[model samples]
Target: MSTENYPVVFGTEDILRSLCDSVSRVLSVTTQSQIRYSGMVQRISKTCLKPDIGCFVLFDGGFSGLVVINFSAPAAMELYEQYMLNMGMSKDELTTSHTSDEVSNVMGELMNQSVGDFTAKVARELQTHITQNQPKMMALSKQVILSVDTHLEKPEARRVTFFTGRNNIFYLELAIDRTEFIKLNDFDASEVPDPDALMDQVHGATAARPAPAVSGTSEHDELLNSLGM
Candidate 1:
């Protein structure tokens, strides 16, 4: 008799969960606020970009998919303000309206970061690569629905609800080709790198390095002299 362990199967819902986690992780860290998603996910017939603010990006390669994040006006403003404040911007310097071009740009940037993280995880965990287009953002006063233009023979759509620390709500919609990954062999997934730790390492190395020798009366020497070095 032959003994073998069962292969691990990752299906549609697993992929959706991974994408949701990426969004939560990126936004939470960037804004220095808590971001949580619904425990239940909705199986939708199609994905659409809804009113207030809508951002979308398309990815292709190992799998083709579309990601859409629709934010309510309040939710968009909350996240934008939080992120800006975390970056050391004062409240007076922040925009009050979600429809402002600056608001759209900031939201787009956040979406880009989130999707970039998701793609990296796909490469590491799924052992496949995917490339994403630049995120597109729109502010809409009325309801508007947009779908992916790319072809997905058997598309699966899902929507997950996300909440900001202030309890503002947003929705994430995903449409992807129905697919699965079955692990054939045992392997550990790569650990995600910690940005804070990486920055500390860089600073430590710089501090330990000797200053480069400067010719007579150079700006570097002048600075060092001013510091009584």
Candidate 2:
């Protein structure tokens, strides 16, 4: 059978799914907690930053888009606490309020990692590159509607619900140009590389390498004698 006959189409929802996977994967690993998203997605006209913690990142290159994650106060604190605890920090040393700059910084960092993973997958799976700007995070008291500064032709927006290990709810919003990628031929998408496995391989190779020969007094004497000194 000709492969072209069964062309696979990748569209807006597909891209949103990839971004959601990256979010879940990165957060799950970082905080050692179960992070998941709802299977059903909401089609929205625009993306916004909602209280209590709002974060957004813009990306361009292969495709331009904006990613917004609105975390409730409880959701923000839960993730921040879990991430810090995972890093060996005691609960007493943690901040209790999500309004703290530290909490915003941590959330922003996680958002950055999530988008980074998404972009990497896009490069590997879609065979195209995208560049993301630094994530901007704010502790909002009210909802603020924001749009991407860059013009997106035929823009499409989506919102997905996410839950942390503690069942704290948050929302993820994505706005991108309406685009589709039709597969022309069959190819396997590359898997994400494991950092721990890569480090183990490096250490194993280093251990297997033979040490360089060291010069001793006997060898020095042998050299001197060979020189007729």
Per-candidate TM-scores read 0.80, 0.79
What's model 2's lDDT at 207? Answer: 100
> 150 in model 2: Cα distance from truth in Å?
5.3
Worst 10 residues of 1 by lDDT: 1-10
lDDT of 1: 0.91
Residue lDDT tens for model 2, 1-229: 5656655667899999999999999999999999999999999988888899999999999888999999999999999999999999999999998999999999999999999999999988988899999999988886465554536888899999999998999999999998877787667788767899999999999999999888676877998999999
Residue-wise lDDT of candidate 1 within 7-83, one digit each (tens)? 55678999999999999999999999999999999999987778899899999999999999999999999999999
lDDT of each: 0.91, 0.91
Q: What is the alpha-carbon lDDT for the whole of candidate 2?
A: 0.91
The TM-score obtained by model 1 is 0.80
